[model samples]
Target: MMGWDQLAAFVVVVAALIVVPGPSVLFVVSRGVALGRRAAVSTAVGNEAGMLVQVLLVAVGLGGIVERSALVFSVLKFAGALYLVHLGVHAWRHRKELAVTPEQERTTRSSAQILREGFIVGVSNPKGFLIFTAVLPQFVSPDSGSVPVQLLALGLICVIIALISDAAWGVLAGTVRGWLGHSPRRLSFIGGASGAVMVGLGVKLAFSSRP
Candidate 1:
């Protein structure tokens, strides 16, 4: 039941927010650089799907509960951090394999695993709850009849914007990766660098304090 004016404002705000690269963006781009555009897009979709879960919880009024519970937030954060670390370690160990033929890489790494990793990265990020709690309420009008509906609508918009924006990053990174893949030595270096980025992100997340 939000008016056009409100909807337009919300869109602008969310557009700005989505354009600011965050952890999700980093993960998607890294996957693109390491794997390819298809994997990157799949990861973006999975990440959005994971974010949808958070939106649902917020719509159902559980967002406050999550925000208030340090234990719950810590668990989610750690789960995401550990998953990223696992991915980094796996990538580092298989740098040589990464330099193999594209067909061989596809055979070794399944699409399902890539998507699952993206979903885990999405869902386990505790920061989503904070954003939902703080940002969604501002767009909800008292006369909107249903706050939950408004939250869902706004959350969907955020996710859609993010999907589009993050996909762009993926495509750009994938293109660079394609060029880099011309040489086996360069490909190996690319793999190692991507793994290091993931590990660094994981370590940063693990040590991050609650907001």
Candidate 2:
């Protein structure tokens, strides 16, 4: 097993990694700004759950095996891209409905829907697989005892840090969103911009070649 110093170093690195805004974090912020902080936190929790799944899959050699196969890589990539485009379209199509109103605030997305969406994104995200496939293995050593256990420990720490950081962002976004509620026109602009970004990301993902 890695020493205390080594584990602490890994935690620091993990924290730094989470600070970089990824799709998951962006989703939470947008949801928070558009919906509420509660929704954003729920989404982040779902995202963290998805991330835990990725960590576990990688730990057991499953992620490596799938990544090693060119066919599997292509399939996963395309599938992820399709999902992204689907989400982008969904957001764009439902822009009006998602636009917050006093009454709309009374009801929010279901828990099942939140978790389902979160799990789907985590499982389907090729970039996530790529990150763990490359990053996790780098810190692991056969001499350090069970690689899987180390991975799980590292993964949990990563997820915890991300959840906290993202929740913080969600709170901040939610505050801004609350203040802007009266300005529907400005809110609309923000929503449109976020939608466009999602679509652009989907397009980029769709066209990316296997590494």
Candidate 3:
């Protein structure tokens, strides 16, 4: 068990990390801009749900195996990269659809599909797995209690903070979407831009090396 002092410190560190825009944040923003607030928030929830699964795996000790094996890590990374590229290309091709009514945009994709997509992205994120493997153990106090319990607790805290932060970003982007919803051209542009961002993120992730 982590003490109040240790937990507080961990929260501060995690909050700082969450505030900085990362892959998760960017993905959520894109969803908000392209889909709407509901989709963005749902994506955030699904992403965090996937993150929670990772935390559970880490607590059970499988995370270390994935972290230590370069082949496994690379495989996961490429899978995520390819998935993002696939998503980006699909979005770009259907960008014109976004120019329709905002109501239509909101109803374009079911919540389940968006959640599934987000979950896959979250789970396949190798960087996120590495972060958990590397950071959670640092705060574990072997003498205090079970290391797995502590890791789970710390990981939950991280996810909560991220959810709140990512949701806020999504809401903000959705608001922007509302403002631009009037113009079909601008809406199409937003769709295109969001797709481009996702594609760029995928390319960047593909080139990233093990750290």
Candidate 4:
């Protein structure tokens, strides 16, 4: 039962944050460049699914514990970073696979596997969790029907905006992939470069201090 004014403001804030091409967007773009539009879209969907779960936890009050506990935060942060690094290394090792036609490259990894990876990344991302913990409560009011319901509604709005933005980025990257599909060398280079980006993001995340 958040007020229209609060909801609108929340939407604006979420939209601004989501459109900035953060780690989540980069991950989807990487999937698009390495895999294809379908994989990218699937990854976006999966990432949102994981985000939704985080929102649920936030609504249930567990999110505060995570926000307060440095140990838990570090554990989640490192887990996500390591997973991204693992994925980047795997992609770099298979960089030549991008040389295949889009149709064939799409088959390189199953949609389920891609989705699962995206989900893991989304759920384990300490940044995402912290954002929720910090932002979601601000717009909430005691007069609202239920704090949990308000949080869920706000989180859903955030997720929808993010999914649309991430999907657009994925499609754009996929178009670039299509353009370079004709050249094996360029496709290989794209793969390596995208993988390197992921690795860099992971390293940055690993070294980032608690806020």
Query: What is the TM-score of each predicted model, taking all chains together?
Result: 0.95, 0.86, 0.96, 0.96
lDDT of 4 by residue, 130-177 (tens): 779998899988886888888888888888887899899999888888
Model 2: per-residue lDDT, tens digit, 1-211? 7778877887787777777776667777876776667767777788788878888888888888777898888777677667666766776666665556756655655767766766666566675677778767777888978888977777777778878987888788878878877777767666665566666666777787766
Q: Which parts of model 1 have CA positions greater than 4 angstroms off?
A: none
lDDT of 3 by residue, 51-152 (tens): 888899999998998999888888888888898888888889888898776567557778899999889888887756876898778888899788888888
Candidate 1 lDDT over 24-126, as tens digits, reads 8888998898888888888888888888899999999988788888888888888899988988888788877767777887898898988888888888877
Q: State in Å the error of residue 72, model 3.
A: 0.8
Return the candidate ranking by TM-score, descending.
4, 3, 1, 2
lDDT of the structure predicted as candidate 4? 0.86
Residue 31 lDDT in candidate 1: 84
lDDT of each: 0.85, 0.73, 0.86, 0.86
| TM-score, cand. 2 vs. native | 0.86
Q: Alpha carbon lDDT of residue 175, candidate 1?
A: 87
Error of 3 at 129 (Å): 1.2
Candidate with better lDDT, 1 vs 2: 1
